[model samples]
Target: MKKKFKNLTFKDALFNIANYTVFFLFTLACIFPFYYIFINTISNNDAVQKGMINFIPVGINIRNYLALTSVNDLGVSFVVTVARTVLGTGLMVLASAFIGYLVTKEEMRNRKFWYRFLIITMYFNAGIMPVFLNLSMLGLTDNFMGYIIPSIIAPYNIILVKTYIESIPRELEESALIDGAGYFMVFRKIIWPLSKPILATIAIFGAVNHWNSFIDSLVYMQNAPKLYTLQHRLYVYLNEASNLKDIISSSPNAAAMALNSKVLKYTVTMVTLIPIFIVYPFMQRYFEKGIMLGAVKG
Candidate 1:
């Protein structure tokens, strides 16, 4: 066996080596940044400020975490972020899945027109000002609905899912119909089950998007601090810390307080990132399947 393996062509050996090299390098590149951030986040403020820490933390401390969790609105913001990510992602996935299934049906009337309409929206979104105006008209501004509603239907995801569903053999649908299964029954029992890979992909994408979304929450729900997401809370904290340092510089105690703010920033960033990072590994296997689902022709 060893002799036979060694006798493989030079071209095959070279290809295998090159493939492994590229894969190793790619993995290192992806992991290094997060490792660097983790090291820096744990390092003391003075060590971080002096650039003394690299792959390993220097003068390690948990004071940053203490400062972060001790902040007035951090708890509220955390709760809001969790709720928004779950609800928003759930709604988007359900809507995208149903719409994707519908649009993939060749027998559906005006399927081509609906597909073109969605493709158009994917390329040409109404500007933000108009979106805000429309939201204002609907009284969704400064509410939880504002953040969740606008993100419920992503055209790009719908298209990806549609492509994946289109790859499924139509013979399956015909067989189900022959068995007297209605359209709804076929979709729920057959199509949805078959479309798991794409659905998982869309779910992960939507969940990550909603979890990391801060700008929309900031712009639309500005008036509702109670509804502020983690990102928005971090933004507000950074702004407040900056302003406080500037205003309170003449006071001795305030200067020391601002030194702590630097630590808090890194800690809060780590805290916000940790939950999402933890969830990612669980979805990693599904993610590759989902991405590749629509790429290959059936």
Candidate 2:
């Protein structure tokens, strides 16, 4: 079989090479920006200033990272961001999964209407002012609840999950009922276990969203510097780092500090991304299976 497969004609070999070339170029296009950022992060300030840094680091330096960690409020913001990602993603996945399952039930009254209502929400949203006003009414402004609550129910995730769940074989549910299993039991034992891939996908999506969220934090967290998330902290750092020349003219040590802040921005970006990257590989196997199972034809 190997010999036969390897015995391709010149035309076939050309086609295969062309296919791989396109994919390789596409992959490089996607990856080059990240590579540039990484290189820039480690390159020397003088070299960076001279526009010498390209795909490679000109003079390696760790100053940017050191400066970032030395900032007073960054540590607190890191912890806050991690906590929000965990709690917010957990709540979102659970709520979405339950809602998905509920909506998939054919016998449920007004199911179509509920699904349509949920889908409509994805297209239309109350503006930031209304959201802020509502949060203030609920006394959630400047609170962690403000960050986590508003994002708990995602309409798009709900629709994806619902479509997946509806694809589950009805016979499986009938079998569970015949075996004297209640709806909850069937869901817990079978549906939940089978839905791990989609759950992981949703969890990762939610976590990434929560971790990167800055607009909500900025709008709702008035006078609450301690409540700033990692993204917000990074944003502030970048802004401060850009203005470092003026800051350094007043204080000689500020240039070194700014350099450190630049390095730290890269380090923090890597740090924030590492957890999700570690998680995704393990979940990927289940994700493919779950998606296929959830989308199985009747």
Candidate 3:
């Protein structure tokens, strides 16, 4: 049997065309700036400075990256960045999942009160001075824990995890409980597996936050130069040349290899963004579904 379909109206066709055209334009607007930066990064420094490189390359040169990498501290910064991203994201995801699961339990005392308390903190922030003073007193300042410990629990993430858990069939946990499995066992075997989507979402959020944040390192690790993050290093690169001599000293042929400090900024920016670009694509599918599912109220 042949299926019959109604022909599209002229108005509807025009509307669809307009919508797609707008979407394409919007995508181009967002992407072209990054593309322009990439073109500039690889283009000749003279061409870039002369404004000759725009959406197209003038010449290819990887010298910016080479010069940037010649700095020994860049390697240290990269290691620090990776460490914080992994530990911070992992802790946030685990903490949110566990706290979220606990709050949803009927047997847990003060569930509503605890939930309300957490939700209230989402809108309420302790002032920066107070937070800094508290962190100083606790010795979290100038410590690696400054990044991981403070960000382990975000109330919004907890809510998303809890909402996602609410959608899961309770009958699964009930059956496990009937089989003499404890709550932790049930969570380990069942809830954790089922909650992968939201976990990935929260992980992405936490990872990006830790990767991009520089203020914590600046304020907390003021006395500790070795603990500066990649982001803080980049900020220093942009604002001053005090560190350039240290970097230049690393290269044996430093006199011949001209380091274009101007273009190095773009190269460093691209480098900073690379991990996010790589990781986001893998999580994108789960990310979309997770946010939607987490938004739904059971």
Candidate 4:
């Protein structure tokens, strides 16, 4: 590596410097927002409120986080979000894998028609009011199942899984079947194991969607605050900070009133994002490989 660096021409050296500089700036840009928010949340309430906490913290404290713990309904919102994300991701992965595998079978009746039907839904959606009416008719409105049921079958995820499965050698599955293994057995023992890359890819997608989703809660749980997801609750909390301040000021919770609203907002934002930050790094290798391979063919 030292010898190669010494041998580089002026043009090559300049190109390498430019490439590294661009990537370094881009990475900094992506990371700066989170860092800025974090520093403000830790800064003293007076400094944060006076807008003096940029770039570095001043008189750092953790009161914002402590104050957030006292917010009403936060625990329930958190439980709902966690439950939604876990159940939604697991069920979607299973459904996508099962449907994806089924579409690859030539022996299945009307396979093309069914596959095309699924694909077409990707290009179109009924208007929001019609969807609301449909959900109402199905008795899904104001229900927790409303969050999971509508999202379990995603066409784009199915396509990724189906394309990845098709790339696998058919003989492996054929050999499993030759040993008297049924379709489910072959899937569990062979295909499922071999399709980890694409499955992980879809899992990441499902987890992120379910974690970040608030629209469903906003639309379906408007009258059911008990079923509200964390994102939706946070959305309400942030938007209502002005009105909330007056209420909190009169309350007996000194920690809640002492913390600046902006600081608390930043704290809550970090709370929501920390889980994704922790989980993404472990799955990134699979995510890159899976998306690339899945997109290459379809």
Model 3 root-mean-square deviation:
2.4
List the candidates ranked by lDDT, beginning with the highest.
Answer: 4, 3, 1, 2
Better of 2 and 3 by lDDT: 3
Report the number of the highest-lDDT candidate.
4
Clashing pairs in 1: none
lDDT against true structure, model 4: 0.88
Candidates' C-alpha lDDT: 0.80, 0.76, 0.86, 0.88
- Using lDDT as the yardstick, the better of models 3 and 4 is 4
Give lDDT tens digits, candidate 4, residues 1-298: 9999999999999999999999999999999999999898888878888999879999877766665666678778888888999999999999999999999999999999999999999999997789988998998999999999999999999999999999999999999899999999988998899999999999999999999998889988889999998898789879987655554565565434465578667877888888888999999999999998888885
Angstrom error of the Cα, residue 202, model 3: value is: 0.8
RMSD of each: 3.8, 3.6, 2.4, 1.9
Q: lDDT tens string, model 2, 120-202?
A: 98889898999889999999998988888889999877766777776667898889999999888888888777777788777
Per-residue alpha-carbon lDDT of candidate 3 for residues 1-298, written as tens digits (9 for 90 to 100): 1232246677877888899999999999999888888888888888887789877798797777666667777778888989999998998999999999999998899899999999999888888889999999999988888888899989999999999999999999999999999999988999999999999999889989999989998888898777889999888877765467457646774556545666767777788887888999999989999999999994
Count clashing residue pairs in model 3: 0
Enumerate residue pairs that collide in model 3: none
Off by over 4 Å in 2: 1-12, 58-63, 242-275, 289-298
For model 2, give the 10-residue run with minimal summed lDDT: 244-253
Q: TM-score of each candidate?
A: 0.86, 0.83, 0.93, 0.93
